[model samples]
Structure formats: C-alpha cells, structure tokens
Target: MEDFYPSRISEKPQIMKRRDPVIHTDRKHDHEAPLTKDQLDFYEENGFLQIENLFSDKEVAAMQKAIFELQESNSCVQSEKMIREPNSNEIRSIFAVDQDDDYFKDIAADQRLLDIVNHLLGSDVYVHQSRINYKPGFSGKEFNWHSDFETWHTEDGMPRMRALSMSIALSDNYVHNGPLMLVPGSHKYYVSCIGATPEDNYKESLKTQKVGVPDNDSLKWLVDQGGGLSVATGKAGTITIFESNTMHASTSNMTPYPRNNLFMVYNSVENKLVEPFAGAGERPEYIAVRKTTEPLGKEKILK
Candidate 1:
C-alpha cells in the first residue's frame, strides 16, 4: 500500500549472508537442560536464569532474515519511549500476529522451552502472547524495569497465571550493544512499580538512557538492590528464562549497531488475561492457543 517504512536501498544483501551474531543466531538444543531440582530452587530463589548459546548459527540466520524482512516492510514500529499504537513505523519493533511464522512455529514445538515452563507452571500451558523486538543502532529505545504479569494480571489471585517467559536473543549482545537487564529474585515480590500516571511511564521518562550504567539515585538503588546492573550479555542465540513476575528491562542502543530479540509468554491453561491499562477500552492484540493433545513430556508437567 503506502510506503510506511523508509526504504534504504543498500548493496549489501537484505538479510546478512553469514548470520552476524550482532544481527541473529541459529536455534539449537541448549546445554541448560530442563531444570534440575537445584535449578528450580535457584529460579524460585533468584527469579531468573541464563542459558548460554541456546540457538545454533543456522537457526539464528533464518530468524534474522525473517526479522529483517519484517523490518523492511514496516511490520514493526520503533520508538525511544513506550507508546502503544495499533501499528508503528520503526524498523526494530514488536508485532501482534493472527498468523504463525516459521520461527514461532518452531518455537511452539521446542521441547526444552516447554520443559522449563512445565517445571515452573505445569504441562497444560498455552501461549498467551509473543513479541518480536529489533533494537537497531542509534534508534532503538530502552525498556525500563517492569513486570509482564502486572501489566495484564487476572483478578482472584489466580494460581499458575502467566507463569514463565522465554526470551531469545537473536543477535550478539554486549553491554555497549544494549543487552537486557534484570533484578535477581525481584519476581518473588509479586509487585511492579508500573507507572500509573503519564509521567510515571518508565519508558517515556527514561527514553534516552541506558541500564547497568545508572546515572541517578533511583537507578542506582535499582542496580544496587539487584545484581547491581547485571548485563544480559552473551553470545548470539542465548535464551533466558524468568518467572513472569521478574522485574527486567533493556539498555538503550548506544553503540552504532542494533540488537534484535524476541520475547514469548506462556500462561497456565487456567489463567486468563485482564488488561490493566486498556487505554480507552481498546483491546490489545493478544491471542490464546488451544490446548494441544500432544504429550508435554514429564519434565514439563509440574508435579
């Protein structure tokens, strides 16, 4: 239709040929096996854990290509601050889809991811929501400290609610390259200082800032109380698992490169969504999956 995303014609291929870790990595079976008793305890106690080199080089290539294609077409919206729109024009951004893609389809069948979720929430889990994020150099914004569950928590203190999250880094992320950050064990608190007022919107207020390198007192408190700004730095294709209540955020893209990643959320079958900031009662683009008949493996089914 109309040219929404400003097209940049470059001699370089649209999708980088060699699969730059700076851009994407391949999906692979990770060493971070489904949680042992120790890992489960660690997760319970710490709120988050890391899986190194979870994706292979090839998988990263395909995912990166797909994301770049999406970016070129303006299917994503990019901004420095958090402002919700039905659609956006930014190259590096997230999308709500009614259809499935190869990447997500593969993610849907990933046993290891399911196994971890099962350990935490139980086997009868469903894909509550998924987001594709591309953080481009100089333009990518910061996602401040917050919890996903608090943003859309159902009433009645539902058990096994949005239980867990799987975040895959599509590209090599370094401290300067704007990696994700988290507050260890913060999820156990079950509270999120989500900005209720316009000024309180962390994304809006801290648009032009970086995490891990705090410049103010509030930020210093956040860094100190937690791991004191633990950078989610890792090789390309790393996947991190965290409780849904985990307080996490990402640094700003200060370097001249971009950081692209995807975040997927799964809810226990019994849980439903209740949007806190419905914004004039407009429904956000979130979809639920049907309960599948496939066996979720013993590892996934919580005892």
Candidate 2:
C-alpha cells in the first residue's frame, strides 16, 4: 500500500504553543462537584465504565425516530450507488448527526453528562466529536480496532491530553447487536507514537511485544492478558465512557433489529482538530449541530 501518513501539525515557539481552535478551556456551563475521588479512582483503574440511563425513555424514542429517518435517506442514496458499483465498502452507514440540532444540543448540554465530563476532565472540557452509528439489517461489518490519537494531528511531544468518548445506545445492545468490545485498562499502556507509518494502513505497532499467534489466537491471548473483552450490553439509554487510548471495536450486527448508537467525543480545550480528519468537511453534520453555551474557542460546530 502507498504511504499515507499525515504530516504533523506545524510547531511554533515553545513560549507560544499553537492549539486546536475548536477546543476551548473555558467552563461556561455550571459545573457541579466534578469527579469525586472515588469516581476518578474508578476510571483510572478500569478502561471503561457504564453510566446507565443517560437518556430518558422519551429522549431515546425521539432519537429512534430521527435515526430511522436518517437511515431511510442514507438507504436511498446508497441504493443508487449500488446500481453503478457492485462492490463498495459502503456495507453500512454511520452518520454524525447535526451537533447544533435540538437532539445534540439537549443531549450534549445535559447537566448529567456535563457533570460526568467535568468529573473525568476538569471543569473546562469541550465537546469535540459527536456522531451517530446506524447499522441497518444486521450488517456484517464492524468498527476496526484503532486508537483515536492515531487519526489526529498535533505538535510532536504534545501531551496525550485528557479525552473521553461516551457511546450511547438507542436500542437494546447485545453481542449480536454489536455491543462495543473493550480491552480493560488498556489505555494505561498506550504510547503516543504507535509506529508512525502510513496512516490508513498503520497497524498498531505500539504493542509491548509481538502478537505471534494468528488473528483469533492473538485475540484470545489479548483477552486473557487484559481480563477479556468488555461487551457493554444494555437498554437504549445506557452510555459507556472510556479513555481515548483504550482499545475498542464492535462485532458484526447479527440480530434482526438494527443497531444504533450515539457517540460524543470530548477533549480538553488545548487539543487541536487535525484538519481533513477532525475538521467540519469530514462530517459537516457533526460540525454544524454543535451548541455550546460558553466560550469554546474557534470550534467547528455542526449547525
């Protein structure tokens, strides 16, 4: 494969470091007591945790309606493409909803969510990436395992910086329904430079040692080494949060029902959006629907 590694963001003087304009360090929203000592300890130890009932039944219902609408529109578009291209990687569609829309504004600004974010990050955290995953008809597709930072752009030697993602299910999640699988506490072992080879074809060379076995064997060994894959399963309103460095992916949805989930990515104000990857055009809906109450710098909000 051709080398596709992205160039690093240009660095500036040490005295005046440049940061992502979209990230803001201001705590505009009212913050309750951030993370209690126990909550912090819990996150530090476990790579992931489940926050049950993040959304109410009503909210979930509304989201379900919106998701179906989006899916219907997507199906029509893909169907047309199918006429020309018989083979396409477009087996499924995962959309980033409008961040500035009523759904996102309400959910992103939900005091409960803000409280949890404040707990994980400090009071001045910013909502970075918010998207919806819509898999139709038990598609035999999965989100391949990868680290978020690998796809990001930043000055060399920059800190990992606090980041978190909340995956909220809009339908009952199960192994068959493609519940997310996470390796426990794996983030602690992550290194910043996970072998900076070609971007798209980059394998996670950051492993401490070579995984000598075959794919299934290595996965089994990994499960044994990391206490096993955490299959987060639950009802529509449950949300699971984890560190950005945590290793995670999902299996093919095999159930008759569709699997839909919303993802909200959060990062500190200092993290810059790596253009072409994290910028608005990559997913315009995500950038446009963002509704922040406080000063968040020059973020690419999806309105």
Candidate 3:
C-alpha cells in the first residue's frame, strides 16, 4: 500500500487534502446502539460525534473504580506501560488498559461498542491502541494539536484513515478543566509536519509530542476551514467517537477538577498497520499492535 498521508520527513510543513472518507461504513446492521442517520451525517461533515448518557451511572462508576484500582496497583505503577509526567511521578497515561485488567477488557469487548465499531468501519475491527488518560488538578499538561492519522501513518504505519477514536468520559469534562477540543471539520485535510523522527520517539511522545504536530499557520487554516473549534464537555458516561484524522488537543488543567479519559482506538481489519512510512523500524507492540491483526470477533461481520 502507498503512503497516502505522509509526515515528519520534510523541512517545511505540507498541507494536503485528505483522500479518505470520514465515515467508512455503509450497510445495514442489527446493532441496537448504532449511530443514527443524523449522527452518521454529522460525523461525515464534522469528523466527530458526541453521544451523551450512552453509558449508565453504574457502568461509569464501575469504570472509575477500576481506574483507581489500576492506579493503586503496584504492577501498573512500576511498569513501562505507565507514562509519567515530564518530570514528576504523576501518571499521565496508562497504556494498554484492555490488556492490564479484566474490567477494562470486558468494557473493551462490550457488544454496544463492538457493534458500533463494526457499523463505522463496515467491518470487524481490532483494537490498535487502548489507554486511560489522567489529568490531575492543577498539574495536567496540554496535548498539542495534531492528527492521529499523521502520527500513525508516519510512525505506526496505519496505511489509511480507516481508524477512529472511542473515548468515554471517566470524569466530568468542564471548561475549567482540560477538556478535549477538536476542529469541527479538520479531518478533511492532512497536515504533513516538518521534523525528523528521532530514535525511540514514542518514549517521549507518549508523554508530550513535539514532532508531527501541526504548525501555527496550518492550525489557523484548519480552524478557518473547519468553521471553529469545538470543545468536548460532558458529564461522565458521555461517549465520543471521532475520525482518526481529526485535529484535536487539550489544555493544561489549572483547575481543581481532574479529567480522566478512557481511550479505545479501533482500526479496520482491512486497514491493518504495516512498516513505518517514515522508513524506520516498527514501534513497540504496546504502542502499536503488529502481532495480532485478528478481527474484533471470531469472524468478520457485515461481509
């Protein structure tokens, strides 16, 4: 497959039009929780969809407890799966949450999520990455603006924009806190950032990303093109699904409220990863799964 979306190999940033669809699915499904037609239209036009109160209070509480347990667990705190803040011992993110605990694993395999993923990608999907992000009060840092597809293609070798992000709010995301902000229609374009990929870049980028980030001019242009930026603010149990190429970021939390988000990124089975488009060695399995390309379930649905 060709590298349709390339990044981090030039001295000047390149703004290229996206050649992929925002929503890849087009078929009937028995998914009780499938996105409605209006929701599908919204995503195709805006690159994101937010559904409030999708999960129940009980489910949200359960996940919250699981997160606290994982945070207190010695194994997560002592392992490489944990990503700390730049200087402090604060846990910025816990990678591969689905692999770490049965609670997360069950949530990952939940039929509603799986069915919706199937409807979105038009195929059975597998988890490309999973993590729980924590932004403690007064200490959470910002995530700079960038497209996940750009990094995935350049570093992780995701050949196409057939992937999407499914993030559930584990805590109330407020304006005062570092809630996610996304460009409304940013997935229509790709930003080819200017930088050289350093060796073991994931080690640093997993905490703070410098390379593959959109430049100021490019961000301005995208905002103009997208109409404006939209903040994802919702109570716990709110669910958001966005295109993989959507331009999104978060601010540094200075408020007393902590914002925690659980991410389960799904990729089309047909769009499985390959060698890095930047011509480097593959990243670790924990960052990007390469060994297992199996479909979400035992077999492909909607085939």
Top TM-score hit: 3
Quality of model 3 by C-alpha lDDT: 0.85
Error of 3 at 273 (Å): 0.9
Q: Can you write out model 2's per-residue Cα lDDT over 19-50, one digit (the tens) per residue?
A: 22111223342233444445455566666778
Those runs of model 1 whose alpha carbons end farther than 4 Å from true positions after fitting are 1-33, 73-88, 154-162, 192-227, 274-282, 287-303
Clashing pairs in 1: 21-172, 25-60, 26-56, 26-59, 26-60, 27-59, 46-185, 78-90, 118-300
Cα-based lDDT for every prediction? 0.52, 0.51, 0.85
Q: What range of 10 consecutive residues in model 2 has the weakest lDDT sum?
A: 13-22
Q: For candidate 2, what is the lDDT?
A: 0.51
What is residue 97's positional error in candidate 1, in angstroms? Answer: 4.9
Per-residue lDDT of model 1, residues 77-122, tens digit only: 4433223321334544444421245556566547767766654564
Candidate 1 vs 3: which has more lDDT: 3
lDDT of 2 at 34: 48
Model 1 residue 34 lDDT score:
62
Candidates 1 and 2, the one with greater lDDT: 1
Show model 3 residue runs off by greater than 4 Å.
27-33
User: What's the CA error at residue 102 for candidate 1, in Å?
Assistant: 4.2
TM-score of each: 0.67, 0.65, 0.95
Candidate 2 regions with alpha-carbon error over 4 angstroms: 1-39, 73-100, 153-159, 191-225, 274-303
lDDT of 3 by residue, 1-303 (tens): 777887887899989998976666643432433777788878888999999877889989989888877887744447788988886888878898887678887888788788778877877888899999888889999989989888889899899989999999999999879999999999999999998888888888877889888999999999999889999999988998989999999999999999998999999988998889983678888789877667766446855
